[model samples]
Target chain A: MSDRSLSELGEQGLLPLLQAFCPAEQRGDDAAILTPPAGQQLVVSSDVLVEGIHFSEATTPPAAIGWRAAAANLSDLAAMGATPAGITLALALPSDRRLSWLQQIYQGLDRCLKQYDCPLIGGDLSRSPTATLAVTALGWVNPNRVIRRSTAQVGDWIMATGTHGLSRLGLGHLLGEWTLAEPLRDQAIAAHQAPKPRLDVVPLLARSQPAGTVWRVAGMDSSDGLADAVLQICRASQVGAVIEALPLPATTSFDRDRLIQAALYGGEDFELVLCLSPDWAQALLELLGEQAQVIGQITEKPVVQLRLSDRTEILSLDRGFQHFTTH
Target chain B: MSDRSLSELGEQGLLPLLQAFCPAEQRGDDAAILTPPAGQQLVVSSDVLVEGIHFSEATTPPAAIGWRAAAANLSDLAAMGATPAGITLALALPSDRRLSWLQQIYQGLDRCLKQYDCPLIGGDLSRSPTATLAVTALGWVNPNRVIRRSTAQVGDWIMATGTHGLSRLGLGHLLGEWTLAEPLRDQAIAAHQAPKPRLDVVPLLARSQPAGTVWRVAGMDSSDGLADAVLQICRASQVGAVIEALPLPATTSFDRDRLIQAALYGGEDFELVLCLSPDWAQALLELLGEQAQVIGQITEKPVVQLRLSDRTEILSLDRGFQHFTTH
Candidate 1:
C-alpha cells in the first residue's frame, strides 16, 4: 500500500485521474459556463449522496448508484420547474474499487442526463476512504414558471402527484424493515433506485394564470414523503394543512398507521405538493386531469392533521424524518 | 453517544445543529437568489477542499481550517476581480470530530467572509468519516470585465499575484520540516493556515483596463504554484511562456530550486495568474502596485522554458502535480 498522504492523493491522484473522463474543454476556466440554447434560466442545486449511508455497500448496484445520483439532482431541478440542462459530478472513491463500477456510474449518469438532455459537463474526482458524491445540476427554466417553496396559502387545496408510501415501502425493503418477494422486491428496488422526478407539469403550473401566480399552492419535492412535505409546506408558507384520508394515493399492502407515517416521513418520493385555491383546484385537475389530483386542503391552524373522519382528525405521530435517529 | 445513521441527518439534522448565520432576509427561500446591488453583476465559482490530506491532522487549527475553506472559494472570485458577496458551505465532517471544533471552523469562516464583506448565505451539512468542504462563493463583477481563463493570447504578458512555495513550506514546517525559530515558524504557519485571497484588486484592475476588457487576459486562481498555473494557462489559452531566472519574486532566504518547484506546482497558492498585453504590464502594476505585480509574459511555442543566461534556455519540467497513477 502506498503511504501517500490525503493532500497528495487529493492533488496528484484526483487532477490527473480526472483527465480520464473530464472533458478538456473546461481545463482552467473558472466555472464551466454552460450556455443553453439562449433565453433559458439556469436551474442549479447541489446534493451529497454518501455510501453505507445513502446506500449500503452490498445492496447498491452500480447502475442504480449512478441513476439515483442523477435522479436526486434532477429532482431538485424539477422542484424548481426547470428543464434539465447539464451536470457536474464530484466523486470521492476508495482506491480499491473496480474501474468497471466507476464506468457503470458514468454510463448510468449518461443515460439519465441524456433522457433529460443534460450532459455531464465537469467534475472533480478524489479519493477518500468513504464513497461520496456531491452533484450539482444546472437546468433551464422560463422566468414565468419557476415555482417557489413558499407559495402555498391557507384555504388552498393540497395535492401530490402520485403514490406516497411506496418509496418508504421500498426503503423498508432496503433496510430490512420488511422482506419482499422477487417481483415485489424488484419493484421496491426499482423505486429505491430510479425515482422519476416530475418535470412534465412545470410549464402548466408556471403559467397557471392569476390564481396560480397568486394563491397557487407552493411546492417542495417529496423526498421525505407527502406528509413531511405537508409539514415543510406548512412551515415555509406559514400555513397548516388537513390531508384527506380517502384522497391520498399510496402503496397497497401498506399498514394504515405505517402508511400514514410513510406518507408523512418515509423519504424519496419525488412528488410535488401543490397547494391551490379550492376554487382553482377543480379547474387545475380538469386542465391537468391525469397529471394531478386534490389530496388535501390548507388550514389556518398550525397543526398538520389527518382527516379520517370529520370529528376524528389524527395528528401525525412523526413530525419529520430522522433517518439516523430512529431507523 | 447517539447512534444516529447518516439518514438521520434528515433534511436537517435531528439535534437542531447550530443554525447557519445567513441573513434572516436571505434564508427560507427556495434558494438564496440575490439581485446584485446596483452596478454589480454577480460573480460565481466553486471549489472543494478535502481533508486528512490538505492539512496534517496535527497542525491544522480550527480557525485556519475554517479560514482556508472560505479562502479557497474567495480566491477564485478574487482572480476574476469580482467583489465577494455571499457563500454556501457544504460540509461533510468525520464522525469523530468534536462539535466544538466544528464550531471553530465556523468562527474561522465568519472572520474571513466578514472581512471580504461576503456573508454566509446558505449551506448543507452531512456526516462522513473524513472532513471535506465544498464552497461556492457568489461575487459581483463589472459586466464588461469578467475575466476568463481561455483568453490569454500569444505575446500576452503573464503576471502572478504573490510569492509561491509558502503554503507547502508551512506545511512542511508543521510536518517537522525543520526546527524552526518561533517567528519564522509563525509566519510559515500563518501562510499555510490563513492564506490571503486578494480581493483588493477587483475595482483597481477594472479601472486599469489592462486589455480591451479586464476579461481580455485569461485568468484563474493559482491553487498550485505560479508555474503550474502558467502551464494551465498555456494549455487553456493554447500558448507557451518563458521566465527570466532572476525575476521571480520570493522571500530572501527561500531555496531557489524548491521555490521554483513550489512556484511551479505547490498547490493552494490562492493567487491570480494573469496573461495580459505587454503595454498593459506597466499599467497593470500602476493599478495594482502594492497588491500584485508583473511576473512574466506569454509566448507562441506552446512550451514553458526558463532563460538562465544569454546562451542557456532550458525546457521547464511539467511534473509538479501528478495525482492519479499509483501502483
Candidate 2:
C-alpha cells in the first residue's frame, strides 16, 4: 500500500481501517451497543498516555506505544477484578505522521484487545503537536464481588502478582545504562512494552468466601510502583504497612538495590498489589504459583515501615512516585 | 488559596476537589460500578480535544475548554439517542497550569454533567507538553431504538435540530474578522463554546413506533460541519441527498453567502441532523417548535445535490472541515 498522511485518509477514509481492527460485535455508528450480562455491573476506567510524558519516540516504537497505552487502561479493569469487555481510544497525532504509523499502532492495540477479548468500539481522532492516546476500557463484574483499594484490613497479608520492577529494568536497557544478553534483554523489553493484566486471577479472587464470612481480598494495579500502591491502600483504609525483608520475585539475577529501588519507586509495572486475609494467603499462593509473592503485611499504626534485611533496621521510606511532586 | 501547579496538587491531592464536583452516584475506587437498568443497552462514545487544535488558549477560557470537550462527547450520546449516565475525563496538562484554572474547568464540566444528570465517575491526570482533554460519556438506549447513521432511507425528510452556522459565526467574531454588538456576539460565542447537546430530545426521538410499523428516523450529531455530516450519512446509508435553500434558524442577521458557507463547511456545531419520515417530520416539528426545521430530503441517487433558491441552478458542493487536511 502507498504511504498516505492521516489527513489524506481523513476521518471518513480512516473509519474502515479502524473498524477492521474491531471485533464484529462492536462496529456501531456513533456509539457501541453493549448489553452487560444479567447480574453484572459495568466497570469503567480511563487513562491517557501523552507522547513525551508516557513514551519518548527516541526509545519506543509506535506499535509498542499503542500496546503500552492499552495495557495501562486494561490493568485498571484487571485491578477491579472485572472481565474486560470493550475499549474506546481517542487519539491525537501530528498531521505530519504517516497513516502507516497509525496502522502499526493499531496492530499493537489489536494484540492487547484480542488477548483480553475487548473490542475497539468507537473513537475520535484529532490533530495535535505531539501524539497522545486516551483509552477507556470497560469491563463487568458481579456487583457484590468488586474489589476496592480501601478495603485492606490491618491484618491482611500484602501479595503482589507477577514480577515487579521489570519495566524499569527495561527502561535501563533501552537507555543503554545497562545491558543484558539475548533472551533476558528481550524479556525485559517485552515486559515494558506489553505488561499483561492479571485478568485470569480476577475471577478466582472475586470468588465468594463462605456465606457468613467477611470477604478478605482488596487491591489495585501497581502502576504507580509497589510502595506508592501500598501507601495508597494504607491511606484509603486508614491502616499502615510493614514491608518484610524477603527478596522480591524475579530479582535474583539483578543488582539488589537497583531492582529494589525500581520495585519501590519506579512506576508503570502494571502488576497487582493485593491485600489478602492471612487464611487465604496459602490458597492464593497455590493458585497463582510462582506469579504471586508475599511482600508485606498491613499494620495498625499509621505509618509505612520497611523492615531491612540486615535484621536491625526498620526504616520508614516515603519515596514512591508522586505525579506532581516529582515532575 | 495559593496558586498551586497540578504537580503541586498531585493526583491524590486533587481527588477530593474533583470528587466535590461529581454527582453522588458514581464515586468509586478503580472503576465506577454502573448497573444499567433492565432491558436497556449501554452506549458509549469518546472524544478528545487538544490545545491549538480544537480551541486555542488565546480566545478560549479554561472553563469553556472543559465544557466544550464534554459537550462534544455528550453530543455523540445524544446522536445515538442515548440517555446520559456518566462521563470520565482524562486530562493532560503542563505542570505550570494553576490548580485554580483546572478547578474552573471542572466548574464548566459540572454545569453540563448536572444539566444532563450524567455524573463524573472517574478520571486520570498526567503531565503533558500541551493541555489536552479526552472525555468518555456513557449512556443507555433501548436496543431496538438505536438510530444509526446508515439507517436513513431514501424519501426521508432531512431535518436539523437547532442552528447550523452559529458556531462558525462565533469563530469569526473571536478572530475579530467581523463585529457584532452586545448579545449577538455573546450568543454566537456561547454557541461556539457551549453548544448544548440535545439530551432532552433523545428520549422523544427514541419513542418506539406502533407494532410492525417501519420506523424511518436516522440521525447523527453534526460536528464536522453540516455538509460533512450529510456526506457521512449518505456514504454510510449508500443514499443521496437534496438540500433545499431554506432559511436556517439563526442566520437572519448575517450575510447570506458567509452564513451559508459557514453552515456547510465550518465544524464543531454539536447539533443533530435527523432523517425523518414525512409524516413524523411535522409531529417532530411541532414538538421541537422553533428548534427544528426541514433542510432537505434523502434522494434515490448516490449524490448530494443542493437546489438553489431561485429555482434556476443546482450545485454539488463537498466542502467541510476535515482533520489533517486544513491543518
Candidate 3:
C-alpha cells in the first residue's frame, strides 16, 4: 500500500505480493506443474523488454509496459495458431523502484492474461540498475493445425489482420514527432501502449478452412512492421511477394508517403501477417469481414517487390527495427 | 570471426549466430513446439541474473555467466525431481559488447545444456545498458512422484546433497575477501563460478525408496544457503527442525565457527535439502556414499534449532542472502 522502494521491501517481503499473482497451490514451489491438453502440442516463446529499448518511463505507464510485454509473447502464440496456456515472467528492477509501480505492472499483466485465458504460473525477481522484463509464454495447439512461417506456397495470398501505421503514429504522437485530432490521437496512443494480440482470430482461421480439406497456412506476428514480417516469410519459405498495397490505417493527418513509410518500417504493430491459398483467403476475409485484408500475394522471384500504380520497388530488409542500430 | 559490436552485426546479421545454439528445425519460428513425454507433467521455472547484482564482469567470464544463469533454472527443475526437456534464453546486452563475447556466452550455455541433455529451443535478444540473462527451463515429472517443500511430516530426517561452504568460500576468494591454498582455492573458485545442479542425485533418491512403497519426501534447492532452505521447508510444512551438524567440507584453513557460519549463511550452493523417513535416509546415505549426509531432523515445535556440543541456538531466516539488501 505504501510507495516504499524495493530495497525497503527486500526479496522476502516482495515474494508474498508476487505469489498473489499466481495460483495458490502452485506458489511456494521450486517450479510450477502443468499438464498439456490432450491431442495438443505445447508452444513456447520468450521475449525481453528493456527499460530504454522497448519502453520509456517518460511516455509509458507501468501498467502499459506490463500489458505490452505480455502482449508481445501472446502475439507470438497467435502467429503459431496456438491457444494460450500460461506465462512466466523473469523480472529485474532497480532497487529504487516503488512497490506501487510493480503492483500496477502486475495488474496490467493480469488483465492481458485474463483476457486471453493465460495464467501467471511462475516468475523470478532480481535487482538491477535498469528494469528488464523477460516473459516466456506457453500455448497449446493440435499438431496438425500448428502454423509455420516456412510453408508459404508460391500462389498463396498474403493477408494481414487489422490496419497498420496506427501504432507507429501513436508512438510519433507520444514522442511529439507528429500530431492528430482528438479520437484518433487517443486511439493511436492506446494502440502503441497496449496492442492486442490476434489470438481471437486463430479459431476463426480454422473455421475458414473447408471442412475435411487440408491447407497449409504460413504466418507470423508483425511486431517489427509489415515489411520485415513479409521479408522474413519470403526468406524462410524461399518465395517472393508482390505487395499490391499497404494496409494503412485511416489517418488524414499524415501524407500518403509518410503513412506508407510508417506502415512499412514502423515497429510493434502486433498484427498477424498470414499467407494462404486464394480460396482460404476469401473464406477468411468473408468470415472476418473488415477485420482482415489482402495486402499482397506470394511469387517465385525470391524478392519482395512493391507494385504500386506508377512504380515498382524492392523493400529492403535493413530498414526496420534492429536492436543495436540507430534507425 | 570478427570482434565487431552487435550494432555492427545488427539483428538480422546476428540471427544465424544465435540460431546455431538452438535446434536447427526450431529456429526461425514464432514459437517452438514441444511434446511432453507420455504420462508426465511439465515442470517450468524462470530465473534472472543481472550484472553488478549477481556477478561482476571483472571476476566472472562471459561463458560462466551464461552457464551459471542456466544452472540456476536447472537447479529449480532438479529440486522438483524433473528431467529437463528444454531451455529458452532471453538475453539483453549493451550494444557495445563484442560479438565474440556473446558467442562465448552462448558456448557456455550450450555446454551446460548439452551436459544435461537439455536442448536450446528458443530465445530473444535486445539491447540494454546493463547485461541481463533470463532463462526459462522446462522439465517433465510423474504427477505422483513430484517432490514438494510443503510435504515434510513431523519426525522426518533432514538430509542434504553435497558439502556446503565451498561455494561461499569460492565467492569470498573471488571477491578478495579470503585466501586459501592451491587445490582448495581452485575448487572454491570453480564452485563459485560454476555450481552444478544436483540433478544426478534425483534418481538415486528414487532408488533409495523401497520398491512399491509410496513416500512423501519434501525437498528444495539450497541456493539461498542451507539454513534458509531449512527455514523455508519448516514454514511451508508447518514443522520445525533441529540441525545436528553443518555439512562442512574438509578444510583446515578456517576454524569450526567460521566454517559453520559459511555453511549456514553463504548462498548459491545449488545443493538439495530434503526431508524423508529415517529408513529412506539410511538407504539414500548408502546409495549416495560421500555425496550426501544426514544433517538434522524435523520436529513438532514451530522453530528451527541448531544443536551443538556446547549449546543450542535458533537459526534466523533473515541471515541468508536477499535481493536489494546488503549481507
The candidate, 1 or 2, that scores higher on lDDT is 2
- lDDT tens digits, residue span A1-327, model 3: 569999999999999998899988789999999998777888999999999888997668999998998999999999999999899998999999999999999999999999989999999999999999999999989888888999998999999999888888888888888787788888888999889999988998889997767968898989999999999999999999999978888767667887788888886889999999999999999998888999999999999999888668899898888887887
Query: In candidate 2, which residue pairs get closer than 3 Å at backbone N, Cα or C atoms, i.e. clash?
Result: A324-B7
- Give the residue spans of candidate 2 off by over 4 A: A181-183, A206-214, A245-253, A311-318, B24-28, B206-216, B247-252, B311-318
lDDT of 3 at B306: 96
Interface RMSD of each: 4.6, 1.5, 0.7
Best by lDDT: 3
Docking class of 3: high
Off by over 4 Å in 3: none
lDDT of 2 by residue, B9-123 (tens): 7766877788877655565477788888899999999888888878886657888888887888899898888888889999888888899899989988888778778888888
What is the lDDT ranking, best to worst?
Answer: 3, 2, 1
lDDT of 1 by residue, A1-327 (tens): 444444435444445444444456555566544434344554457667778767765566887788888987788777777777667777777766656667677777777777776766666666667777777766666655666777787788887776666666677887788876666567667777777777766666644554424434477788766766778778778878887753333335545677666666767877777777766666657667766767778888887877766435545525665433443
**Candidate scoring better on DockQ of 1 and 2:** 2
lDDT of 2 by residue, A1-327 (tens): 889988877765786787898766567477888887998999999998888778887667988887887888888998888888889999999887898899988999888888888888888888888788999999998777777888899889999888777788888889788886666678778888888887888876744243466665688888878887787788778899898844354535678788877777776888888888876776778778887888889999978788876543333324665555674
Residue B297, candidate 2: C-alpha displacement in angstroms: 1.7
Worst 10 residues of 3 chain B by lDDT: B251-260
